[model samples]
Target: MRMGFTGMTLDRADHLRRDEQALKLARMHPSARFLLLDGLKPVLAPDADRLLWVRRSQAPDNPSIFLGLDEEGIPHFALAGAAADVGGIATDARAAGTRLSAPEAGIVALARSLLDWHDRHGFCAACGAPTRPVKGGYGRQCDRCTAQHFPRVDPVVIMLAEKDGLALVGRQPGFPAGFFSALAGFVEPGESLEEAVARELWEEAGVRARSVRYVASQPWPFPSSLMIGALATADSHALSPDFEELEEARWVSREECAAALRGDGDWSAPPPLAIAHWLLRAWVEGQVPPS
Candidate 1:
């Protein structure tokens, strides 16, 4: 199954990111395009199905991040400040997925992640000194100690623990009413992906995972994370839900999950934009453990 934010079609020219002369020439290229953002929202073309790209001359005079080149060697950039009120409609990233093609959604993910990283990492973690953007916004350099830093993508383990053809699902306290999805947690330091999945299942739902298998992955750029999807065989069916981490935890059959995804049930599945939805769909269709 296709996941959101995974089909970027750009040729990320790493060779030009540090070459000032080459980057300058790229910026001046006649085919260069600029993607304008209203704050963090992406501005869509009038048709509202694609990103509204503007010539550099028509773009806002704000700091920009090089997003790489398309097939024709046209350089693409993204910027976030003082976008002109005219031209296109600005849509939240979460909602953009339904309206954009997979490749366009991928571009939004990369652009937003890079721009947000630059905004949040303007200082060196080691020296407490100001850091400047380097490598076309792919990294930063410390002003004081000359240390190099790169963007960080945190890993998150989202999984389903199956026993007797039923999958365990849970909803956090903050989740909307009647909404449940796959159990997930951040991958703690020094832990393997399989280890994290097992730990999260045990910690959140008091379920023991016997064996773990990779399912698929999706790029989740809310801030930035790699959602590692997996399926685990459960040792037993009993559950001891940890109320602190989950509002409720229970087992759902594949039919029940399919109904929720189809909007024919009392509960609503996670939206299509989320990896959780795809994971549930995969389980419902017996695509768990993948092919």
Candidate 2:
């Protein structure tokens, strides 16, 4: 099966060896490279002179640090004061002047979230103690509590619900006109991926689903989230959209969905980079059509 969007598989191999090497490099070198991301988009050609270096509020003894990822999949470590501030990078991306490649954007998302986590998680959750970076910046160690805290990637479920020849699509109030997408939400605590999928559908669009099947997943490090793709069979299509979550919800026929995916219809869907676009395309290609 061909993976959608950039057609790049950020698989196991890409992250395996680089993580350890990155941590070691960070420890040995006092200066490192950093990338910034705004949402899924990355800010390229950042002005290194304007980076922000945050010190640990709790650990007065811990050195201030800089954020950066290495070419070998490792993140760089350095003491603070080497770079300027963080706003310039984000501002650059927003101004439409910077252009970033697909993989580069993905890596930037990874670096931004991981570094942000390191900055915020200077304290151990297990006990009221300060934590130090370990495992090449992948984890932290709490000296007082002897606990290890790893970076976290929250999982979100994004699904396309189908019934008969139509697929369910919805729109939140603030979405651009003529735009609709698969319903989605963060997986809550103590819920399996399947349960989260079903719940989000019902909560957002008032649609109950069955036969929830895992389709694909994407690393959405807008702030460290994993988007889990799924296809579900709608038990009923009576869409009473929850006004709080969704402004409108409805079923579109396969033909209509196909046109939306192709960007030739009255309505335009999300771009190919988003998982919602892939889910809609999967329906049009009959890869995940209604049973």
Ten-residue region with minimum lDDT total, candidate 1: 81-90
Model 1: per-residue Cα lDDT over 112-225, one tens digit each: 888899889888999899998778878999979989999999999999999888999999999999999999999999999999999999999999996799888999889899
Model 2 lDDT tens row, 57-78 = 2112334233344446443333
Highest-scoring model, TM-score: 1
Task: Give the best candidate by lDDT.
Answer: 1
- How many backbone overlaps does candidate 1 show? 0
Q: Where's the lowest-lDDT run of ten residues in candidate 2?
A: 51-60
Off by over 4 Å in 1: none
Give Cα-based local distance difference scores for all models: 0.88, 0.64
